[model samples]
Target: MPARNEAGNLPALVDEIAAALASRGPFEAIVVDDGSNDATPKVLAELKRTRPWLIPLRHAVSCGQSAAIRTGVRAATAPVVATLDGDGQNDPTFLPAALDALAAGGARVGLVAGQRLGRKDTGFKKIQSRIANAVRGRVLGDGTRDTGCGLKAFRRDVFLALPYFDALHRFLPALVRREGFEVGLIDVVDRPRQAGVSNYGLWDRLWVGILDLYGVWWLIRRRRQVPEVTEL
Candidate 1:
């Protein structure tokens, strides 16, 4: 989970995740605290004492969400990694199902992404997302509708091999496909945030996203096919 100033939401989200994944055997929940100024560090400290599965990491200064996600993925001990927003808007119950979907698709499925239904964002935000998604779809043609949804499951090695950038989290499907793997989608019901306001703004993503989109498009066009390797 990539979290910034999400202190109010972490405890409940952690508990919910534990409950949801308890039957799935052992797993680690890596919460990357992206330089939160609030009581976030303290809360994580407290949560850590009780929950061994909680792997709390902190950035010395605030990096964006993509950086945080990259940090968690790099540190992951599991071969498959699942991500969700740390603000409690993303339901933890969907993680197992997403992982299952990825597994069902076999080794070629590099990413299983969540498509949010009934978004709880303000009308303006939802409109902005719709416009962004449409533009991205036309430009990259990654066959994904809601790339902004935070819930995702993928192979840790595949994720680490992808080109990293500021907004890489939002472009996973395109990049994963560029690496010659299939993408899977699952419908996820959105929920209102448990606490705190949104950390992102229209300006923060708009211009950068355009540049990133073109970059990904170029990468897709210039890519070479993956070689089939057979060794003696």
Candidate 2:
């Protein structure tokens, strides 16, 4: 999970992840500290001592959410990686379901994205998201209603193959589809944040993604043919 200055929420969120996935099998939770000025780094350090599954990474300067996620995913040792907002809004319990969905679809499903139900944001924020989702879905035809939902599961290799960008996380479905892989969707219930104010604003939510959207559209339209290979 990518987090900035979310010191108050990390402990509980990490614990929840442990509770949700510990019994399933071996897994690691990589929390990227994106140049947080708060006690986020310290808290992660303290938590690391006890929870071997918790892997903490830090950036000296903030490079935004997409970069943070890239950092964590790169460091992850697992073949399949599940991601969610570091804030407490996303429930960790859904991780198994997402992973299952992705596994069920096998190699064809490169991504299993979460679509939020009953968003907890303010009315204006909801409106902005609706407008953004509509525009993005119509233009990209990604067939997803909530690309902004942070909960997602995919193969680590598949994720690394995509072209990196500032807002790559927001256009994952479209880009995954562009790579000739199907995208799966699961309905996730949203929750109000447990602590700290939201770091994203109007620009971060809607306007900033416009250019990235177009770039993804171009990439999709210009997709190269993947040749079938038969080696005797």
Candidate 3:
């Protein structure tokens, strides 16, 4: 999980995750604290002492959520990586199902993104997301409904191979497709923030994404289509 000052929500979210997937298999939680000014690091330390499966990684200064996720995925030993926001809005109850879906989809499926069914964001925030998603879908043709959903499961190697960027997380469906892999989708009921303030809002998110949308579109068009090779 990529966290920035999410101390208030971590404890309960951690417990929920443990309860949800403890029996499934050997799974680990890598909480990347992105230079939080709150008690996030200390809280992670305390949790680590008790939870062996919890891996706590920290950033000296905030490097944004995408960098934090990349750091955690790089440090992970698991074949598949699951990431959710640290603010407790992503319900841990849906993780096992996502893992199962990814597993069943087999190797060709590089990403299984959670589509938020009922968003709990403010009206303006939802509107911004709707506009963004509509534009992205029309441009990229990624066939994903809710790319903004934090709950996502993907192969570790696939994620590592994809081009990394500051806002790359929101473009996974398109990038994974660019890597010759199919994307899977699952519907998850959105939950309201359990605690702490939201780090994102309308204008801050919208303005930056306009350029990124076009950039991704360019990438799609410029891709070199590799022909099938047959060797003697």
Best by lDDT: 1
Off by over 4 Å in 3: 226-232
The best candidate by TM-score is: 1
Candidate 1 CA-lDDT value = 0.94
- Scored by CA lDDT, what does every candidate get? 0.94, 0.93, 0.91
- Sort every candidate by TM-score, greatest first: 1, 2, 3
Taking all chains together, the TM-score of candidate 3 against the true structure is: 0.96
Candidate 3: 10-residue stretch with minimal lDDT: 220-229
lDDT ranking of the models: 1, 2, 3
TM, every model: 0.98, 0.97, 0.96
**lDDT (10s digit) by residue, model 3, range 1-232:** 9999999999999999999898997788999999999999999999999999999999999999899999999999989999999998899999988999999999789999999988999998888888888989999999997899999999999999888888999999999999888999999989999778998876776768888888888888888983456998
Compared with the true structure, the alpha-carbon lDDT of candidate 3 equals 0.91
Encode model 1's per-residue lDDT on 17-107: one tens digit a residue.
9998999999999999999999999999999999999999999999999999999999999999999999898999998899999999998
Candidate 3 lDDT at 39 equals 96
